[model samples]
Target: MQNIGKIVVVAAATLSLAACGQGAKTQAAAPAGPPVPPSSAAPAPQSKGRECAADDIKTTGKFGEKPTITIPDDCDPPKKLITKDLSEGTGNGAKAGQKLQMNYHLVTWSNKQVLDSSFDSKPFELNLGAGEVIPGWDQGLAGIKQGGRRLLIIPPDLAYGQGGRGIEPNETLVFVTDAVSVPAG
Candidate 1:
């Protein structure tokens, strides 16, 4: 039993050292502590952002259902990505380097128009923090729990910087995302 304990400690130390060596380029484990209350538990890791301003946008729907989002024509967005949970979920929290599946509704901030949505079709699947998706999603979706619905307002720098195939130049994107699942190991 003593030898087993020593091996466990050594393995944990090695993992900690490896994680530290990777720096900010790699995501770290959540801080160890007592359970965080639901109200304060879902903020994305390392995001320098605040809660959503109520008047900045509006949505009508329950979690697990498609939401109707409205962005007033004169609404001005913040420079950084902001997240707000419409409903808190119970499950393992999302993290970087995991394969995540989400149901998302996307809108263009300037026109207040929906650009694309996965509600009517298949859920979108992507490896979190991978370049397969835009940086906004890579950063905004971290730490979300399975079944949680998050509202994300992504600035131009995080979305498509200038323009992409279907997005406008310097577009500030708005998304309502549901963390459908993260496959278990």
Candidate 2:
């Protein structure tokens, strides 16, 4: 019985030492430097745009139906023109290759909170005819005269599609925009 007890203790000790050695080897083999920060390993920034949150979207109506949009009172009203009515743009005013400057605020249709804007100081410029922006911008900005302010309710199909870049997928976008300038031909 004494010998058997001694053998059990020896086996336990050997197993413990083996575990300890492996643990030490693992510790030694691990990188000695400080842990890398998560930010350092993050994916590179993409320029498509930020995505919207899923909670920000609301599609109660049937597909292909344009949602109703209400412009806030603080939004500047559309202007009137003598030679041309600037209130509602002609929808054919802008052509490809022409640069346009405009102040815009984008919000979610469900909450009406401003998700993005370029209206703080200077207006944002874009080639109207080019396909540089979302389809809504290209189609919505077409034919709109300069100095006009319009409200555009862009559906997901026109705005971001299923997965909106930088925002949520299939989100409807609302924009109040003032067309500040349009380059002449």
Clash tally, candidates in order: 0, 13
Question: C-alpha displacement of 43 in model 2, angstroms?
Answer: 30
Per-residue C-alpha lDDT of model 2 across residues 1-185, encoded as one tens digit per residue: 99999999999999999999999999988997644447756453243343332222332222122223343433222211111222654234667778998777677644456677766556888998688887778877777667666556676777676554565554567766667786554
Q: Lowest summed-lDDT stretch of 10 residues in model 2?
A: 77-86
lDDT per residue as tens, model 1, 111-143 = 678899899997899999888899999999988
* Model 1 stretches with alpha carbons more than 4 Å out: 1-55
lDDT score, candidate 1, position 171? 77
The stretch of ten residues in a row with the least summed lDDT in candidate 1 is: 43-52
TM-score (C-alpha, index-matched) for candidate 1? 0.68
Candidate 1: which pairs clash? Answer: none
TM-score for candidate 2: 0.51
